[model samples]
Target: MSPVLTYVLLVIVMLIWGLNVVALKLLVEAFAPVTMQAVRIFVAGVSLFIVLYFLKDLRWLNKKEWGYTLLATVFGVVGHHSFLALGLAQTSASNAALILGMLPLTTSVLAMIFLHDRMTWLRLLGICCGFIGVAFVVLQNNGGLGTISTGDLFILLAMASQAFSFILIKKVTATLSAGEMTAVMLLAGSVMLFAFSLWVEPHGLDTFSQGSWWIWLVFFASAIIATALGHVLFNMGINKIGAGQAAVFNNLVPFFALVSAFLFLGEPLLLSQIFGFIFIATGVLLGTGYVDEKLKRANLMVHSQSKPPVSIHDQIEAQGQHKAKSDSV
Candidate 1:
């Protein structure tokens, strides 16, 4: 695909994701956080199970492979989603976007530390610069990662769980078909959450309603749109590009989110926001080796005035047929 098309796809992904953040923020008002998420994942898993049932070989998995479903559940559903729900209760939508924006950096670092990934020194420098830029965006008002309030820190940990899950999925890639792995993992996670909701919440299935539309809206959005369709689009995009490239494109999430927030919450758009875009775009480029450190500043200037510019890294990596790293992009 051409670079423009590739980026447009990224924008679409980010926009959907951005809207989700805003939607979820609206959701926590009514639902007991974990209770709401459990419903979402359960329904989402059911949806995928239905798809696979029609697709054939739905029950073809051997017992040994199905064992890994437990691990996928721990990280993907139980660990990640539960923490995110709790964290969302504490953090701001913009804070979530900015912190979650660091997924690429976190993934790269974790891969290097535990999964034996490598990068050139220039790329490393770029990563450092990218973090530095994030620091400016987040802490420009204060100093030293200062924007990371206690609630923000909780959400930050939730983001870290996602990165850790990525590496864990990489280790399990050999044992699972992308679809089977994802479906099984979601099943595991959803079941676990369902049980937890029963045990932890004061009222179980017999519990009274929380609020109007809030519970149902969060459930449908999280389960249907965010879990099922979002993953499908993300993994489909990952197949066209690569996981690393998808990670880079994910840096656009905050941009989408900022717009969503403006539309929904009437949040202010600051000049610092522009700088964050520059740094994130440059970091993605550096991560992919499409541009040098010196060139980032220039590209930043030009792209600021243009329509969303095509990231060359996107074009190069997205070229040719490739398998997706289908671990819930």
Candidate 2:
């Protein structure tokens, strides 16, 4: 696919995920967090499995592939969803949105450390901007530093887990297709979540039966569209572009989440959030090499324009004139 198309798809994925934050928050308020997430992920996993099976792409992973897939499942699916659900239960969706916006920086740093990707000064500046932006949003509600809520801490852990999983995903996708890996991870992760929920909240499953029709609708939409399809497209984007570049699109999630939360959950929009969005967007551009790529292209254009290419005839004529002048001298 064209780069533009891939980028558009990534943006759509971010929108879905942004709205999903509100969906999850609503669900958790109505049901147990881990229990809801387990069922949601299970639905997504089953959907993907059915699709893969129909396409004749389903197969067993080899031993090494299984190792990586299981590890990725633990971090990406179980850890991320578990913490995210718990965090949203206690925090506003807007707060969770801004905190999750840190993914690009975290993913880029991990990529640099684990994948040996080069770190440019521009990207470093971007990371700094991202931190400042998140600080603005995170500290806005509380008076200042050291007053962050437990919900925010859980969201941070969730972001960190997802970022680290992106690094592992890069490794796994070298040998397995993104869809296949996602399917296995989601299914395996859902099983872990179910077990955890069983231990902690034995009656959690009863909450599912108590939900209204709209709540069930939200659950299915979140599972199929946001979790299943969203990951498939996102992982495909990672496979096409590098992980860091693809992660920069995550900057859009906070903005989308902010809007969605305001509309759906009656959350108030804050001035600090607008400023935070700007900083985070700018940071993603710089931190993910988007601005750097543009600069490199601009430089190449300037150099080409300043020293235009010479034709073979022009070169020969210049050489001949030079030789005549030298002979005369």
Model 2: per-residue Cα lDDT over 83-181, one tens digit each: 998999988899899888888778878888899988899999998898888877777754345566888889989999989988888787778877888
TM-score for all models, in order of appearance: 0.75, 0.87
lDDT agreement of model 2 with the native: 0.87
Q: Cα deviation in Å at residue 108, candidate 2? A: 0.4
lDDT of 1 by residue, 191-261 (tens): 88878877777574443264566556666876777767677667667767766556666767787887887
Where is the poorest 10-residue window by lDDT in model 2? 139-148
Per-candidate alpha-carbon RMSD to the true structure:
11.7, 5.0
Cα shift from native, residue 51, model 1 (Å): 2.7
The 10-residue segment of model 1 with minimum total lDDT is 320-329
The local distance difference test score of each candidate is 0.69, 0.87
Which residue pairs of candidate 2 clash? none
